[model samples]
Target: MSLLKEAFERFAPDYLERYGQSMLPSHRRCLTDISSCQTDALDGSLHVCQSCGHEHYTFHSCGNRSCIKCHHLRTDKWLDKQQDNILPTRHFHYIVTLPSELRPIMCSNQKKSYKILMTSAFDALQKLASDPKHLGGKIGAIAVLHTWSRAMIDHPHVHMMIPAGAYNKDDDTWIRGREKFLVPIDALKSIFRAIFMKRMRKALPKQIFPQAIWKKKWSIHINTFDSKVENLLNYLGRYVYRIAITENRVLAVSQTTVTINHNGEALHLRGEEFIRRYLQHVLPKGFHKVRYFGIMHSAHKQTRNRIKLLLMNEVIIPDRPVKKKSTRCLKCSSTLILSISVLAPRNFNCQASVHPP
Candidate 1:
């Protein structure tokens, strides 16, 4: 069994008992799904090996997006889909981070705050890139929201992958930004700060503290991505469907303590403390962590088609490996046949198998 599954099973009840009153419905759902994931609480499919006449039970997965066991297949599919959308041009990697003082506000209002974060960042990039001094064209940006630091602290930031050029509507051509630069860092920072503050203030509660954050200089970091699409996809796969804590990172989970490797440093935490920190990153239901804006927006089908045709002659994006379906037996190396499909018992053990008649 996975270490994460064990941790959740052991500590989730205590964590819920103490903090259930304050937890969001989404948080509860995430915990329950993860705890029951691949367990008998979900369901199981009875399979029989055709050659060995061996009968075994395979439990159903919760299919929760945050479940580490479930995200690998989704991540691969997402990466493959992105290959078609990757523009054949230079791209820039930009990071927009919120002021530390606003972390509490963002945590309470995750959906609204995260939406504002992406919108403000994309607005800033599009506005600056359209200026004649920069590139004077409409740019495309794909931003992914991440809420945790290496230490699992609440660090809200958006990582944007932007094409380092723009499509000039009037000239009907693509105008590339400077080979090494996308926009002036100072100018981008100012615009992002203004827009984010304006939107966030409206969404925030009326009685929140620390108005001094308004005076702070928000961070806007930019770096040119000179690598190919393959490298970018590989890097993005790590974060695309990542959970707060994967099973591998969990070193040991005892009755009262959990140990993890945080940035190569070992840190031990109370079981309830670990669950609390991990669940903090569980996003609200129906909230999208990754979004596309400007020329890459999903609504701009015609525009994307035009851009694809314009850049059709460029280097082709290599096709992703096709995922093989799970139809074969692992132990006997024979095709397995589904025999029975029904809801599983609450305490059925997955390791126990029924012998063939």
Candidate 2:
């Protein structure tokens, strides 16, 4: 049996009410989808061990995306899909972020402005790389938007994957960027800040746009990138499906607040109202914060295919098959056999698609 089963058995009615049933409209729909996927009970009898006299029965998981007991399989599948997309070379990991002051604007203007930010950032990188003095080529990047900090605060930022080469349009040459430096940090920071702020101004109504954010001069930091591509790819793969806050992060949840120890120092933090605000900022319905750009962009597959061929350079990454991890019961010294079940399609994706968002 799994940990979920143990919890359900011990907790019974309360557990059933909380996780067994659906809450929101989306939840109800997902539950319905999962119900369609489950096989009938098929008339099985409970069994008991003769010597130990232990009895056990069987039940099923809702297989909903939001359910903690579920989604592990789905997360694994997503990780598999991304591993195929990684290219050979020293890849760099970069985080593009807006100042805390600009978060409210980001919240109000979610879809359009967010896309604009990605576009502007991407454009800046491409332009800087294409310059003969800089790198002189088109850079490939995968950008992911992260809206929350460790404690669930509304911190908007973009994590990017930049391989160290570009298709030089000018000379029609494959120019590898400086291994030590992909793009000049100061130059990228300057260009990215201007492009993002400019696009942001265009996204909002003139009346509501804040003059301070628009007019003021602020330093937007563009940090150093990683030298190893494999390291960067693995780092990105783990964070793709990150939850707002996990079990270990929750130090304590009082009647009025949830105390999250980010650094694990066990600091006692409080403020009921603040906690509410933090949770409230946890992404509204159908909001997709993660996105892909460059060759990975949905509409630009033609360009992506061209770039993929160029990056190959007769070098191929071996397909290392992934196997299930160790199968062991946590509480007792016992081996566990895993069963595979094809579940009814769940509404895990944003907009109720076939895949996770």
Candidate 3:
């Protein structure tokens, strides 16, 4: 079992008993799912080897987005799907972070705040990329929302991957950006801050936020990526499915404290405090951490295909189908067949072969 799961199984009940009434349903559900993940509390599948009649019983994954044990396969599959959409041109990576002053409001109003952050960031990018001084055309962007720092603090930011070129619909031409810079960092920062504050005020009409945050210079970091698009995509993929912390970072879990390794340094916190910090990043239910805009949007598939053909000078081919791997017996190294006895009693012994004679 993962150390994260163990920590939760040990401390979650006490944490919930103390704060369950005040916690969000999504947060509570994450606690339950992560604690019970891959345990007999959930369903399981029984597989029997066709050759040696060896029986293997495996518990089903909880499939919670916050569960560290889940989503490894999901991350790989999402990256594979994105390979078809990546453009051949250079791409720029942009990170737009929310001001620290607004974190309290953002935490209290998660769903609305997160949506505003993503849309505002994209809007800023769109406005700048369309200017005659910049690319002078509409650009494609993939925006991903990250809500935690490396140490699992609540630091909300949006990371965008944008092709360093734009498509002009008027005359059907491609306008390329500067080889090193996509847009002026100062201009992007100004635009992003303006859009974010404007929407934030509108979203929470009655709530009063610090006026200084409006004047605060929000952080915007832009870097040029000349490497393979997959490398960048892989980096962003890490944040999509998982939450604040992963299993490997967890070093030790005791009845009283939980220890994690951050940058080769050991950080310890009370189990309750650890649970509180982890739950802060659970996110609202059904929220999308990743979004596509402009030419990369699903609505612009044909336009993307056209651009691909123009760049590659060849007809675009459909992606080859991915074959599903069959499950195999651990002991016999033979393909396992699904048994109808999957619904067998919880006490059913794995040592007893259920394979047909």
Candidate 4:
């Protein structure tokens, strides 16, 4: 059994019994899905090899994005599509982080707060880049939301990848930005702070947007990539579809504690604490964690096509076919074909039965 599966099986009931009532419906649902994923609790299919007649039973996955076992294929597919959209110019990585004082508000109102975070970051970048004193044109950007620190605590932030430069309308030419810097960090912080506070005041309580945060500068960091395009893509792929933690990062789990590796360091957390931390990042149902803004937005096809033509010489990344991985017959080593499928149980208390056509 997987370590995560084992840990959940051993300790999830106690955690759920105590805290489930107070948790969000989505969090409760995520725990239930992860606890039952790829196990007998879910439906399975009986398969027979066409060539060798070897038979096996394959269980279905929960299909939850937070489930580590189920997201690899999905992540690969997302990466493939993103690779095709990358431009040839130097790309910069920008991180927009909310002040620590506002974390509680974000935790209580995740969907609203996260939307504000993304929008504020996008607006700040676009507004700065479009200024005449700056690059003075439009740019493309991909923003991804992440909600965990290296220690697994709540640390909400947005990671953005922007092409270094913009398309100038007046000269009808591309303007390259300085390799050392894309935009002024202080300016980005001020703009982001103002935009976030302005939006938060409309929905959140007045006290949540404190005067101290307004007085203190917000945290925003920008790093320019000097490496190859392949390296940049590989790095961004890690963030595109990752959960708070992966099964591989799990080192050991006990009745009371679980150990995990984070940033090359091993950290031990109580079993209940670990589950609580993991579920905090489960995300709201139907939330879009990755978004495109400016020229990269799907609605701007004309600009996107023109930019592609301009950067045609940078790199042409082909979208290769991803092989579907599946189970095979243990007896004959042949691929298995589904001969029987058990319909999903209508109620959680019931067992699914095979319904052959």
Best by TM-score: 3
Q: Residue 67 CA error for candidate 2 (Å)?
A: 5.5
**Who is ahead in lDDT, 1 or 2?**
1
> Residue by residue across 120-156, what tens digits does model 1's lDDT show?
9989888888898888989888888889987677999
lDDT order of candidates, best first?
Answer: 3, 1, 4, 2
User: Where does candidate 2 stray beyond 4 Å?
Assistant: 1-69, 169-172, 214-228, 253-257, 267-287, 298-321, 325-357
- Compute each candidate's TM-score over C-alphas: 0.90, 0.66, 0.90, 0.88
lDDT of 2 by residue, 86-123 (tens): 55555666777776678787876767767777777778
In angstroms, the error of model 4 at 172 is 3.8
Q: 2 or 3: which has the higher TM-score? A: 3
Query: Lowest summed lDDT over 10 consecutive residues: which window, candidate 1?
Result: 348-357
Which candidate has the highest lDDT of all? 3
Q: Candidate 2's error at 68, in angstroms?
A: 4.9
- TM-score-sorted candidate list, best first: 3, 1, 4, 2
Model 3 quality (TM-score): 0.90
C-alpha positional error of residue 242 in candidate 4 after TM-score superposition, expressed in Å: 3.8
Which runs in model 1 stand beyond 4 Å of their true positions?
205-211, 312-316, 352-357
Q: Which residue pairs in candidate 4 have backbone atoms (N, alpha carbon, C) closer than 3 angstroms, thus clashing?
A: none
